[model samples]
Target: MTRALSHGDPLEGLPSRARIAELILSSRPPLDTYVGWQHYRTHCGLLVPAPTISPRQWSMLPESRQYDYDLYRELTNANLPLQDTPMHDKVGKLIRRRLSSNTRKKDDPTRAGVMISGWGNYGKTASVCSAGAVFEEQWLALHRCLNPAALPGARDLHAPVVYVSTPVTATPKSLCASILGFFRAPTRKSATLPELVRLVADSLHDHGVKALILDDISRLRMHRADDQDVLDLMRAFMSLDVTLILTGVNIPGIGLLREAMWNKTTRQWELPPLESTRIHGLEITQTEHRFDLIEIDRFRYVTPKQIGVFVDHLTGIEQHLRLLNAKVGMLTGGTMPEYLMRRTGGVIGLLGRLLEDGAHEAIGGKELIDESLLDEIVLRRDGPEQAPDEPVIPTDPPSAAKPPQQTKSTRPRNTTFDDHGPASATGR
Candidate 1:
């Protein structure tokens, strides 16, 4: 055998872009599965598998359709990593600090609690949940490796962090009830506020609850006649030496207790996407420290590279590239960004919705996701009455032009000059 000059290992170093592309197309997970459109529709509260289809029919649909339907069924499924913006990083740090402090020997008596307030879809709740999930995962992993006897009573049963959503217009009683329910602590249906408070406090301590996350705090109103009851309940929880995290819309009620616990001069931790001026009339003390999410630059549209990164993260790098080459094409690198930003005002939720709807329309027609599909989706979402002035790009397949979901009636007959319109209908 001729001594084979060893061809240097072809597989060495990072795989070539073409090789990766081949792997993506060959992967079992289809490109459509990871494209996040269905999740957007579900988030917007649109039903998936539509009401017309039974579960059997849904299951019988092609794999691609099933995948989209599954996404629609699970709207909150979009759990993208916190964007690496300054504000998100700051929020992450604050969350880590709060979580770590739960295990500290001496509580920071000088500091009251953390309040994370931000505009809608600014990731306040997601950040908190991510932190809690991380802590829980790490704690559980460590617990699994250690001996059961090494930990004291109930370590296996109770988590280090407890998350609770504040009930809308939450009175002291309702708030306490939600907390008690979280702990599964027993209480009479008619238990008074004081009794409930005492029971909850004891339960929290006994269960070794280290941190309490009260989310959507804006829902809890302080306008009740007996606001002191709410104050007292909070004081009781604070006395437990557990970390307190209150997060919600940047509303006055979010930090009512934190303000009372620490003086106005004391710094508070706030969520980002805030204006330079005072936010929601909450004073920023001289010492006020805030973790803010930077609003996506409104003037500059989201670039295709940024979107590709997002999709790659959500789905996979290989899948993303495949979509770009196969279905997304030049649109991924074109004026689609400006068009989308113009329609959505760069709102994250709207952007997600547009992508989601566009993805489905593209898949249905077995074609690329293009500007025409995006414009149609936007028009349908924003207002079906108004049509974009762009030259129609023929989104729907030639053989299957989709009928408008709803048609506009001819000018409501201008009721004042109606030939037989308003008066005849009302028998006036």
Candidate 2:
């Protein structure tokens, strides 16, 4: 029942809950229970209806009917499959780095560039957006610094960080509008590519942003761009001279990225799933059985003793759960546990769902994600219906071998519903 956006409107005229309340609570009722009914009135006096059966009957309604109705409201609101995952905290460090670096030395002003490199549903947008309050605060601060005379409309350019996660129906114009729109800055009437490029560069120059993050760029380009166009874009950016961070899975044959940076070298960083050490560090205990030890070599700081302790704790927990599964069952339903384990191996990426499912099980005795639960944690990623699958094992490939970059982040909330990716509910 998850509602699809209808002609750009997610709500399809099913009387909103607010309206339902408006129809019901019209006037003062009987003197006896009136105060109590008024106090409990929902929808903020918005919906109205003459209860076919008394309000008492509504309360005494069968549990099955109440559950079904609860689902109806949820699906109509466009809720995702898995909704419990904490927004990943990836953007904080990057944003801090850019903010601090921007003012330390004032060179010619430029736009901030940052890229959150990873697979889909891996917190690319949530990285910066979860703490949107902070971004708003930073924007206000920078807005105060802009001197209008020296730079006309520079005040609007100060809101530097914006989250752009729209993957479907993305065009250059709309994308430009979305970014400029973030600052309440103006764009040319046409919002043409050249015009947008000019305005973005100038605005960036006036305000002095250090980085610009264009996450999920893998999906947006104007289909099959040639190297020459890429070169042109590179040259344009060079004039503005802001650090540009573009993220996406590696694409073959398309040299737009390589061509753009032909004369310049851009730093490339790979963000894989959370390593096994971090997972082990959670310190969750297992009821019974032992866990396995995954070697650690990718990260540099942790010591061997710390690693061993973490492994012991983590494996103990995993083994305990596995044994429970042997007696009970594994987390399976929407996206199979085997599939998630295989693709997302060792990545604490699924930590959110794992915790959520565990919590649900604690309360309801559900073995795995069910239809209703799956809708709770899904983080929707868009693009190709299917792509070549990645290797099942987490082992590294040969130095010369190239592992195809595909989605390594999809997991199910429960077995009850289909996946639609995670979209926000109500608000944050």
Candidate 3:
């Protein structure tokens, strides 16, 4: 007789064929597969730190197990913890205030936007993305994990933050398409500029998008007609009640601020005479008045306070390292801190890259970070053309100071007397 499955049955927990098929069909793609709703949602979720293995335990493992552990450590090194630098704190505060204020002003015709400008490799994208992720997390929790605007019995993804990179060759239509792509909203190939804009606006509303982030804003040259239209299109998005955040490298140097002058008294950017500029029939006044421009620069190492803060940042990174031979103050103690500062030019992104490469090299053999190991790792920023704004090497910090090398004396008098004996011996 056939027996019924019991709670203790080995096969009882196995999924049926139908359940397996459903999972295969419904499972979300990995974040690397696409930069859409699924990816952004996953990114906003919690990230568990990699498992920690003590040096003693690692030493006890078999050869194969050691190889696996090393592989995992390499991956972990690549993604070091995101430190809460001064830039991140400022950006987070500004974004949080702007998003919270915007939510209360639902009936306002337009919302003021934020623009983050800085040098390349200065962590502009990371700062903005982290702030956006935090905002999305709080927004979802506030809405009870449901889209407030969704219709009853309808399934709609709640995307509080929409991030899209400005295309290298952006136009009004192409920019709209980029925004729509984030939501995975369908758009016909033959769709006109106006149609695409309407679709993007609808998607923003339908998905309950609270903030829209457009990175690489410097790519839009105001000198180009297409870029001008794109700028106007962004202004139009501001009217849709979503806070528009634009980040880029050297935004002020770009023509974006050409028509706007900085007012010292008001401490804000203001537009010139309205008659001075008009783009695509839209006054530049709207953009100047509606967008608050802020900057996030690379770390400075001049002042005592600055030096202390820089060392503190290194301390934070050192805490997250999983190296078997990592010791306290590996990065912050001795001459290493000054060495890293000079190597990275106090740029957070470059510092992270340098440490990442150094960690990989350490894991491969030494299992510890030191100046000798870091010297072997080359960085892209080391090029002459891409040299940092500050001097690469500093004269302070006695430990980092290098003594001049001794060279052989060029005077022939000393050699003349010393070689006479050798010449006489040879002649004899």
Task: State the displacement of the C-alpha of residue 258, model 1, in Å, after optimal TM-score superposition.
Answer: 11
CA displacement after TM-score superposition, residue 2 of candidate 1 (Å)? 40
On lDDT, who's better, 1 or 3?
3
**Which pairs clash inside model 1?**
37-356, 87-292, 272-292, 272-293
Best lDDT goes to which candidate?
A: 3
Deviating ranges (above 4 Å) for candidate 2: 1-95, 108-113, 128-158, 165-175, 181-193, 202-211, 220-223, 226-243, 250-344, 354-428
Instruction: Write down the TM-score of every candidate.
Output: 0.55, 0.40, 0.76
> What value does the lDDT take at residue 422 in candidate 3?
43
Q: List ranges where model 1 is wrong by over 4 Å.
A: 1-87, 107-111, 142-156, 226-228, 252-332, 378-428
Question: lDDT-based ranking, best first?
Answer: 3, 1, 2
The global C-alpha lDDT for each of the candidates, from Candidate 1 onward, is 0.49, 0.39, 0.75
lDDT of 3 by residue, 368-392 (tens): 8999999999887733432333432
TM-score of model 1 vs. true structure? 0.55
Q: Model 1 scores what on Cα lDDT?
A: 0.49
Error of 1 at 309 (Å): 9.4
Give me the runs in candidate 3 sitting further than 4 Å from their true place: 1-56, 259-284, 382-428
Residue 135 Cα positional deviation in candidate 1, in Å, after optimal superposition: 1.8
